[model samples]
Target: MGAFETLEPEDPRQVGRYRIVARLGSGGMGQVYLARSPGRRLLAVKVVRPELARDDEFRRRFAREVAAAKRVNGAFTAVVVDADPDGSPAWLATVYVPGVPLNEAVAAHGPWAARSVLALGAGLAEALEAIHAAGVVHRDLKPSNVLLAADGPRVIDFGISAAADASVLTRTGSVIGTPGFMSPEQLVGQPIGPASDVFALGSVLAYVATGVGPFGRGAPHALHYRAVHEQPDLAPLPPEVRDIVAACLAKQPHRRPALAALLDWLTTMDGSNEAPTLRLSEPGWMPDSIARLVREHTSAPLLHTPPPALPGTPPETPRPVPGTPASVRPSAASQPPAEPPGPTVAPEPKAHPAPAPAGEQHEPVPRPSVGETHSAEQRTDPATPSPGHPSGRRPRLSRRLVLLGLSGTALTAATVLIAWETRDSGTPSTDPAPEPGGKSSPDGAPGTRRWSFATGSGVDSSPSVAEGIVYVGSNDGKLYAVDAGTGRQRWAFPTDDHVGSSPTVANGVVYVGSQDTKVYAVDAITGRQRWAFPTTASVYSSPVVADGIVYVGSGVKLYAIEADTGKQRWASSLDGLAASTPMVVGGIVYAGTSFQLCAVDADTGKQRWAFPTSGGASSSAAVAGGVVYVAGWEGKLYAVEADTGKQRWTFSTSGRVYSSPTVADGVVYVGGMDHKLYAVGADTGKPRWTLSAGSEVSSSPTVADGVVYVGSTGGKLYAVKADTGELRWAFSAGAALISSPVVAHGVVYVGSRDKKLYAVYA
Candidate 1:
């Protein structure tokens, strides 16, 4: 029975040691109760399904989950105040948040306005970043898991799936997760990490803005299949939101921008800081652009569930209420089809013939060569069935076989087609120019605006500007070089895997790393491989050049090589991995490792000094004013004396700050997982100004022509005044941007998760 079913046998007064005050809700897991602890603190307690509690593996997993939950801090997630996973009938309890789930909020109140949606999205991203940092993943994240608290949305049901132990049971032997919201890998039972939550958040945000999931609905398995193989339907959403969601739903989990990326994108959306407009005006008040979107989305065969009712509040019959104005008529087209019982199952599906083998499905009948083809008129004879059937009618199938196929097999193309038709509303045409004048640069500045060329993928790597040209590699596996002034492609070289490491150009050679586990030096002008260096693991660190030496790290080893010869000079083993590029300054090669900051001699690759850090460092170090500034995976930004390697000061953030720091004019600028770009005093590490992006900020900062430019996972590239970190201008991209921004000539160049490189001018 659904959670809406009324149950009244004097409603249990107590469960275990807690006194039940009221009903919270119910699901497959059993009923939830609003209870109070001995201390009189209100809590939401979920009773486990009887069958699940009896399973040994399930119980063990639940215990493990409880252990994990105990490790989590309550700042970002709903705190687990108490639980009894070992109870005769297991149950867990968390603080009660008095508000409707986001799903219900949207259903009862209409889709959130863009700014409100952005706020919600940003909050979720922040929560995910925290969860991931704590080494946990919220496998099931939908609008229902988000509580719209008075101050901000609170992430609830944390670690619930882990409590289930083994994956949740689904039809067809599939593992867990909501069909429409699960990431591709999660659908296939692959271990998921933070990226999975990022994907789920993308779906939730899409639903918030467009009243539909990113993927159109169908059977659970079908949604799973599409999630792994097909792109999301984002036509109804604004490009700002659509791009980030698309990035989150990338087929390859690693390709999806991390939670930080998504947070940054939402934080940078225009008008995100504005208060949500409350008064529901006319439907027409939603922009004509969006109304056009409504018309298109309404055309699709999407399905949605009714808004959930408040805890302890039974569903009442619909009746016109006095005092509040009520519409005498339906204000819109008929509501979408009611959601089915389980996302995994579909109701009464139509049958379709199985497709032939892949190669034989469409042979084009082996058309004759153009010159020897028959006359057009003769070739256009009336169509007819082939000899086997003679008639077009299909062969009659036995009733038993048909029943079996309908009951047990995957849905056919015909069923998918039906779902597609229903789910497809006309998508608004947002394939327009992003903004007037692309990113620009001015002359005589330390950083000049250069020509920005499209990379067709996320440019997580850094750009190397040399020889009047700039070279960089992309997640798409293509290394591109463009004329610094003209923005024309010089040439591009393709590699075997994601080219996330930036190219280092020197002595006619361009050095780059690839996810393929190899570093290659290519001809700067010709884009032809000159030499290839294989590594035991993938290379994500950009190369730093100094004094005829090229220093780079792959996995956990830092290699110093001869710049012109492409031969190794020395290799040093480090305590942990380094994912950021290294900075070579004053004969000391400074690079960040997962757990420490190491300074090595440029020539011998011998460690000069090392500073131990409790948290891993994922970003490279910035050197200026005799200080080294770097951020870590642990949410702290540190300033170290460049010469002595002694830590000067550290500033803490609510979320991880993985983006590398940019030092300019006595201030250091960096993006944080906390969804804010911070300007800290270069000497003391004190925050000067913080411009909250409302999403993760993973992209490194670039200061050019007096403006500091950076991109956020939230899909926006912001230009702020270097001195005050004041907002100057921002350009929206199609997806999360992990790529560091490049200011050259007069244009700002950055790559986004939307699989497109963007260039905007201020």
Candidate 2:
């Protein structure tokens, strides 16, 4: 039986004013039923599970939750139409919006292009501002709570964090907040505030663009470890959105810009004036779902009609008939010869001849020799029969000729049948190609191989593709810029040490860091050094540019440098070293180091707030919606509230996760020392899927065009289907590939431990 059925027996068609129409879906605590009110209004009712109803403490907390939810204005949230927390079957009801969840929309529709993303950001920011205006904090702000209503966006399930904020409220011991979505303070059972909600908002934004949440998935322990340490991946986001999201996701509560300010910034964005729309037809999650459907329904083929042949043409050749041999006819020399009726000239046999009886014996026909026939023809007039071979006596009794003719006719029929059967046996081949500006490629075919490129040695760093250029750093101490379309080397900047850091290009400048203890700003067009900033330790962190400042990390300090001058404007010292890069949004810079993640002032690099991690952080941080996701070397993923540095929840991995976390759709993608790639829910931190590779993964990941590209210490790079965590393809190098892959045009580019740069094409 299904889990929901075991918890609540399917019975009474109605509850209170709602008449249950159907069960839309179920979750750990209850079932969500699509129902209609007595007034005939659509609503979604959530009835608590039987087991959870037995908890008196849960009941009391739930009542409080209901009361708090009722206090909020419904304009920015789902209208709480009714509730019966004290009833035999505790339940809550809200107006049902026809639109899908933010997660579902991104998964089914795909990442919103610039406009939609901005509008979404602005709307969510406004919602958060309203929520903050009220006295309550939405501790569990994930993609699920933000529904994409047709009119606008609606935030739901507010104030429930207090009911089962920790595992203590239920027998399952699984908290209410999702691991990747919860803020750092919340994960540690700390007090949550409005800033925490902003953090979650950041995460929501990340998922919309990339399909994954900020922190990756894992068990509770692993998740907690990450919450205490590590940074979320934001490389998959577009340059403009990344800046805003990163700031909102700052680990420090004070560092994050106020929701009111965030809303204004988002509104003024280039695309915010228009509604959000996807540049590509579908988001990263659509292809994965379609692929799953294809595998399940293999019995039926997706067929297409063949295009019309030239103006006038023979109909298509029919398939061969079954049980017929598809081979050439027997030689004419072995067949019986027939006497000429009138003239000596003879006709050639057809390509297909009738088949002879399998076991039948045929009589041989006697005929004049070739020389005799020729002489007879010469002696006769053109149209007259020869005297020796009169029409009445010439070949009237040649049984062999008659039998041979019959056999040839049979052979011809058999040949036709075989052709028909052969064609039927093969897979159907379509003639028309795919349409342009559609889901399919230019040729209209699905699942076509895409192009890939290799840049720099030692792919331990993630790659950034933008403005027609693919930028990446190599262990060989060189940062290379390659053509996004052709994969040809456009420029290579050699550094003093290994370039294990990725590159970020904005405007006309390329920003990258190297182990040489320096961050370089170079001309995107000329590859000339525009400026460089020296650090106290090796620089492995990537760079993020926002407003007029460039945010990066080195050792234990997060620095904000001038975009045009590369001069350090401010620096914040941290408790531990930072390998992960910082995400800049608004005026805040979010980053992690060792066992702590924090937010710094983007303009002055002043410490705003710091949240300690149980383990050190190695992965980069990602911001979206309003949450900050950071993965730790200790095998934990943390979701810290962007504005307050509060812990929302924690999810754990089987092993340490060095690879940065990338967020897309509603899932989080992170590679671990376990050699596994994981997808976790952005709101609940629940496991969606996991895939195993051959070795440890140190390289960060990036999502583009529906594929997740990551490299491992196993010396291989993999392109995985984001939804299913299935490896679509892998490219093996002679040495470990620590560098992440970048996608642009139709190609993916990465560097390996080997000195060579390789390019793979569709």
Candidate 3:
């Protein structure tokens, strides 16, 4: 079969951020699409059938299977990058391995030579070892799941697999595996384990070695009967491999040799005095005909343009404004009308409006982009201070002279203002000119505290800033909005349960999740609850709002809800509890559970893929340039492909990692329980430097103006150079600090277990 087929019109143009290029194939579970990331990395995206997604039991099973598959990171296995199990049409994405299935290869070229068969056995055994190590049992290990790559064989498709430690999704006495390759125990609906996989392995090897099944051709029932009661016809197999295959085909599970033992046997099949490891490093590991077939299959184009959209599904169009003439309406093919011929005039800032009542909707005001200027004639509130002025006073100037000057040099002054703003906006400012040495500037001399805000309980939630207001959640069951300049609370919204999730502010709304199993959207200015969506369990994962959707995790489910109305768009069940905050970028939401980091379609709630780690992951992900940087609780930081979930590299630490990672200027900064902070290369995962802290470093790091700011469990906050990890300054808060730091207007804001929020100088 061809590696890829042309996509039909009904195929999605894009799933999450990945663009669909072609159709890989369709199966009972889903249709697989050849897709590409924003960085042009190829991925195999599988969109599950709608019926399967709606089945609650099936969704749970799929989630568990995806998690287990991600944990299997073997050289000879396809890696899962992302997945969403609770979406309307659940999906998953895996690394696009370019190889032909073993069945196809063997069918086209006949049986493989003894050496090739031995090598294949070793590679597949190693893959099985990895899978079993992750507490997973691949119940169905047929030839179709084995791909003959140039380097070795890759095992794919863990759909029917189950994690040993997880709850069983299948019913007792249910026959779940394929009939032809299933072990005798599996055929009788008995408890299956890793040994079951060994039996299937033998069947596959027998077929590859002699071009016939060990049980011989028959109906599925007949084959089942033979597998259970009759011995395999191994007479056609070569003597060199016959004994090993016979051992694997042992009727009893315990009688079958372990994968390790089998691999050792395969390595010495040549009978050399020196034991040769079956690394498949030697040329000619594959038969010449099979190798040629693999080359031809892999050499085909990885991606192809999908067919055009089908009829009746017109392309997107901008909505027409009320009272606009039909003749003047802009069409999809037409350009907007040109602006009037004149120099672009800056618009005036509008007056602040009164706050709306609770649950009332309000139109959001448009804000100017960076470098955009306000008109000189714009009205200013006399009682309010301007951005640079702190005294709430206006400077007097000669109106006539200013007007004359503006009229004379309007164009030149506007050009200069735009250029200056553009240049400075590109780089984060260490200190603005107006507050060069003011107390508000974090660059003040060491040992100075700018301000502190105290609450009812310790603050673990990170602060988010918007329009001079700082919004954060507290363990006291309250969401507080404080004045960023004065450190005084403006308002606090109370919840029934403790609030550990950090608040996210967007479009005048503050979204947060609480332990009461609810996600709340409140007015950013008034702290009045607008709406709340309830989940089945407690919510600890922080909420992220993007494209009018609010995403948060409650227990094992991640939900996407309408930001304005609080109506659920979709909910994806994970394999374990999701306590890690999600990071959304390029239409994908990256979140973690106890064992895996999952990438989900932000729009559809479908999973794109998942990446397994050595331990549970509570750390939020950082995405940049199509790569994801995340820390696992196992004391390792991983650089994973944003498109394929394949591990690029890993950096091990001496302690566990609960702190989220921050990526800035090509470096990733993270903290660990080992009482140290690390700076690693974003692309290579190579350590640049490390800084020892007084205690465990669980607080996530933040970067601003080329400086890294992070807090430690020792209650010390340190500011270091982003590129070198050299300490610039450290402040003692007299208690442990678990809350992450946030930088705004040159000041660093973090909370400590001392029950106080500290604004420290950078």
Candidate 4:
């Protein structure tokens, strides 16, 4: 889920002194853009939201914090490159750290191993020591705020959290933090300090060691209660670090262990009292899985290389970065080629880049086309950085990452929940990710690749098929429509940020949600946005269209809107964020919330009943045979009565149940992190059969004609016997396949982390 999208009309061409190049993503604070300084240096520029800029008190506090933020120079922290606190619209620029966010990494891959979590803790503890030394309290230190750079995890946005805590916008006494990660002091409005960060550190470690948060997921108020009165659930955590995490989560700030103590425990893991500074570069510093990520993330550009060219096609031309010299740009290869065959993925010899322009400034910035990247020699660095690295000195990052526009996802406790998602129905996703698999050509083994369509970045958002066209969203902030038969682009609709919520099509209209905090309704045929419904938070829940209404969830509310008008029909509040795609069956919209599974009336948008799950419901409810089956982060699958929201039985899995279930012939089919696809009795919640996939199975399974089709992070999609859970055949996508498979007309369609959507022969 990494790549840049071209700038838009609404985007500023220049923010402060940097000339904007491309749009990265949006947050609660404001928009983040990739830009270049006049000296031709790259910078991640974050423009603050106007409302926040208008607050005079906020300006004063922000300036103070920004100045203090400058003094924080830590090995495991992002550098604060620059700031414009007094500008008409405040902005901040820092050397960009191109890596995955900790939450996204954990959810994509799975929890870190015990030792890896310990190593991570040490780095964060050291980072805290530096920030606290600067007298800056990281009020909102959570998974999203921590970026897993190549060398180590970098704690970001530490400067802005304290300013947000003091802001009048959050209301005088309301503290700012994520629901599950906030310390009790922040929840109770007690004075906060560095100790609060330690508490959050504990929560982060628990989440990293075990996928679920320590206190469980729920609404803000519920989290507050649990933080104050309930004990963090550490049952699933590895024994090695359980005590440390428990101490960190202590309700009383004074009772929490100091950073030095935590560091001491970490350094002495091998029984030595010596506290040696940690380096991810050191062997065993992190798991092999994460180490691979560190190598690729730090050594390569955030954008991936383009798919290899096919024979008889135009020569490959790397897209050039705006304002870069034209010599490295396209020449004859720039010409468009004839339409490609219906299905072809041939390899072309690699071509060397042209010479740079005379007296060029530094290296020319190559801007490849969407879904394209430079050659091997070009990807040697993490793009151009202002001397940023996790080894020692960190290139400073601006305000909070989004300073002003920290999308609600990263700003406060306003958002969360995930795996991967697809069109309205089926399961939602959660896990660990590593693109250990390679891109498969048509001539490759297990040659079932009918064709593959690549997007700008990763393809976690599943594909939605409609009228011979497959509609999919990308982390590149665009929704793409491709020819189902030819694998050719039909049209593309761009938003301000990434589009993770899958698309649902009905009545010639495509409905989707974006991290840009808007639900867009576009012409299904033209890819033109018809209207956008704005929300106060990002829309992680995919939209479901039924009758004339579009049912979707954003933040903590489930909304029903007029399909044609883009106007809200009604909004129903929930206990927490809406991460699950809505499932509409029989006039009822069933959705999973942070703490419960909710069934809402399709027309009135009123909750009929909310069945509270022991853990957060990570997947959407699947309704069949009068039963609504759902998966929970607590590692259990629940069989609840569709009509009454009462649990019939709960079957526990050895791992988290992020995959949604599919029922056929009185058996419920589900997959879990245990690397098995389970077939259980629909009525009994007892196992009928299980098929080990050899890797985590986060992709929900689709059942068709006595066969179950499911994708795994192992980079393969397996077709298994519906009755016996025996494998029939498997197709490899060469990357993790978190997107659920869709089967129709004898073809199985799946999206992969490789940034391609594959049409396989079923």
Comparing candidate 1 with candidate 2, which one achieves the higher lDDT?
Answer: 1
- Estimated TM-score for each candidate: 0.46, 0.42, 0.46, 0.49
lDDT of 2 by residue, 1-762 (tens): 011111123443566866665454444345666566766776767777665577677787677767766666745576667899988799888766544455544645566665566666776776666655555576667765665543456776664444323324332222345435666666544566777777777777777777666543321222333444556778888887888888877777788788877877776674334322221122331234433332333322211122233666422222222211101110100000010000000011111111111221122212222332111011111221111110000001000000000000000000000000000122222322212222223441223323334444434344554556656665566777665544456777777765645565555566676656678776655566767788755554555555556666555466766667666677765544444555554456666554456777666667787765544444445554566676754577777787888888778988656555656665666666666777777667788888777666555555555566666655666778877888776665545555454444445555554554434331
Runs with alpha carbons beyond 4 Å of true place in candidate 2: 1-457
lDDT of 2 at 501: 51
- C-alpha lDDT of residue 143 in model 1: 69
lDDT of each: 0.53, 0.50, 0.60, 0.60
* Model 1 stretches astray by more than 4 angstroms: 1-432, 435-456
By the TM-score metric, which is better: model 1 or model 3?
3
Please give the clash total of every predicted structure, in order: 41, 100, 9, 37
The residue-by-residue lDDT of candidate 3 on 434-537, one tens digit each, is: 22222353546643577778888766556665677767666677878777667777788888755656665556666776656678878876677788788765
Model 4 C-alpha RMSD vs. true structure (Å) is: 21.7
Residue-by-residue lDDT tens digits, candidate 1, 559-652? 7765455577788755445434565566776666555677877667788887654344545666666677666555677888878888899988
Candidates' RMSD to native: 25.0, 33.1, 24.1, 21.7
**Candidate 4 lDDT for residue 155:** 83
Model 4 lDDT per residue over 1-762, tens place: 344665555567667777777666554355677767777776677777675576676677778778878888988887678899999679877666666667656766889888788878888898999998887888777776777765677887775655324433333111246657778766544578888999989989998888877875422222444577679899999988899999999889999888888888876663434333545546676667766765665554432223334776432333333221110110001000000000000010121111111221222222223443212110001111111000000000000000001101000001113331222122222221212232233443332666778788766565666567777777677888877666777788888766656665555666677766788877765566677788655555656555566666666667877767777888876654555665556677666655567788777777798776654565655565667777776567888897899899999888655566665677777777677888899889989998988776766666656677777766778889888877777776657666666555566777776788887777
- How much is the lDDT of residue 708 in candidate 4? 74
